[model samples]
Target: MKFKFVALVATAVAAQFVAPVASANDQLAQSICAYVADNNKNNLRKTLSDNRLRLKAVYDGISCDGLPLVRFAIKNNAADTAEFIIKQLPGSQVAQSGDIEWANSNGFAASPILEVIKARSAS
Candidate 1:
């Protein structure tokens, strides 16, 4: 009976430890999304660089095909950061599709960068 009790306690503790690690991906995703929404490009970029935050994990959580991080940059008016994300995802379908559309619609404007994305996508 004591052995069984110990085993159960251990199992419970192990589950507690593992559960948050698994859910961290989603938490990180939401954090990234919120950061973008809040327009914190420096923090967003820093989080992206942190392996624990996991860019792919965040991307997976948001269902974003394009670099959603870039959307955050664009929203924040951080043109340089947005340009970086665009360069990173060159030739991506998200770049070709609604990412640019959303950016333009949201107030990024149809400037040279937006035009380039549209042109490349058109080609």
Candidate 2:
């Protein structure tokens, strides 16, 4: 939780620089990332749906903490949101597994997000 807070703050800080240098793709990514960070499920879904043709950009835009949108959904307890993203981006299962390694190395191995990732991958 503390890490999530810190990540959000860092995202806010980084957003300042990111806004100026961001290309159209980066801007789109940033917007989606912001929605995920804020747990704005409705906006995120709309944004994602609107940019369905730009799936690569959506996948590239990670949260301020470098977390994928699915992890954000897990942290926010937004199971439906997570499910939607998981279905939309099946390749993220590999990324989620990588996050588990990162969490273990970074001392957050007990995170519920990891459990959710594990459960999803098991299915």
Candidate 3:
């Protein structure tokens, strides 16, 4: 009975520790999404810097409204953010992610961001 009580207490303590971490991650994601949606490039950079995260490192892990970071920026008409993201990532990553094709098919062909994507992918 004593062991069971100890285990239950331990589990409760562990859960308390975990909940805050999950909430912190959610808060970070929300902040990042807000920055991208608002087209606030400088704030985005500062947020990432504050978290000690690089765009390239966290790009694959972050999604805003079910869209990848660059895609979310484009969907929100956040051109500066999109361009900044494309510049941060490698050309091959951009090409492989199908961003160029998606942009063309989704009526974003005329966006200057497409040109930037192409320019980045070519190099």
Ranking by lDDT: 3, 2, 1
Model 3 TM-score? 0.93
Q: Model 2, residue 108: what's the lDDT?
A: 65
Instruction: List runs of model 3 lying over 4 Å from the truth.
Output: none
- Candidate models: Cα lDDT each: 0.61, 0.64, 0.89
Tens-place lDDT digits, model 2, residues 1-123: 999999999999999877776676677777876776666767877886786654445464466456766655555555555555655655555455476676577676666666666665666
Error of 2 at 63 (Å): 6.5
Model 3 scores what on Cα lDDT?
0.89
Lowest lDDT 10-residue stretch of candidate 3: 107-116
What TM-score would you give candidate 2 relative to the actual structure? 0.55
- What lDDT tens digits, residue by residue, belong to model 3 across residues 1-123? 999999999999999999999999899999999999999999999999999998899899899999999888878889998999999998899989887778778987777778888899999
Q: Candidate 3, after superposition: displacement of residue 46 in Å?
A: 0.2
| Evaluation by lDDT, superior candidate among 1 and 3 | 3
Query: Which wins on TM-score, candidate 1 or candidate 2?
Result: 2
